[model samples]
Target: MSRHRQRQRERGQAAVEYAGVIALLLFVALAAIQLGVAAYAAQQAGTAARAGARAASMPDGDGQAGLAADAAVSSWLTPKTQSGSCGDQITVSVTIDIPQVLPIFDFGSARRSVTMPCD
Candidate 1:
């Protein structure tokens, strides 16, 4: 009887250890997903900035550069873009808000700048 009771007590030990490891694994997975989201947002910002810069660099693109940049990114993401020209070079800057999977936390904005010679 004594040996049987000792084996029964050990049964719960595996469950406890599994619970601890599972919690850690969940946290790591969530963190990795959040990182992927941030990287995607950054890439989108860079694409939008380059698109805007290319548009503004054209002879007739100044009037529609903002539209071109907005169309290049995800519809859910709101991007703020600015264009500036100095001599023959044009610069476009884009800032996009990173969407949060966890509502209580903010990952902030991803910003990108691109410059090209005016055509």
Candidate 2:
């Protein structure tokens, strides 16, 4: 009877350890997914900035660089874009909110800028 009781206690201890390991692995997986989302947001910001700058630099292009930037990115990103001229160059900047996988954390925004010479 004592041997059987000892085995039952060991089984309970093993179950608790397994639970802890599974929880840790779950947290790591969620963090990895959040990181991927942040990276994708940053890449989108860069792409939008470059596209806006390129459009603004063209001689015949209409002054819709801001609109171009917004259109270049996914709708869910909600890119806030601005364009300005510095000397003979046009600069475009894009800011986008990074999507949060976990609601309790704020991952902040991803921003990017690009400059191109005016034509």
Query: In the order shown, what is each candidate's alpha-carbon RMSD?
Result: 2.4, 2.2
How close is every model to the real structure, measured as TM-score? 0.81, 0.84
Worst 10 residues of 2 by lDDT: 59-68
Clashes of 2: 0
Off by over 4 Å in 2: 60-62, 85-87
Candidate 2 per-residue C-alpha lDDT over 1-119 given as tens digits, one digit per residue, 9 for 90 to 100: 69989887687787889999999999889988999999999999999999888888888655767778888998888888888754589888999999999776678999999988888
Model 2 residue 83 CA deviation in Å: 1.0
What clash count goes with each model? Answer: 0, 0
Badly placed stretches (over 4 Å) of model 1 are 85-87, 103-106
Identify the candidate with maximal TM-score.
2
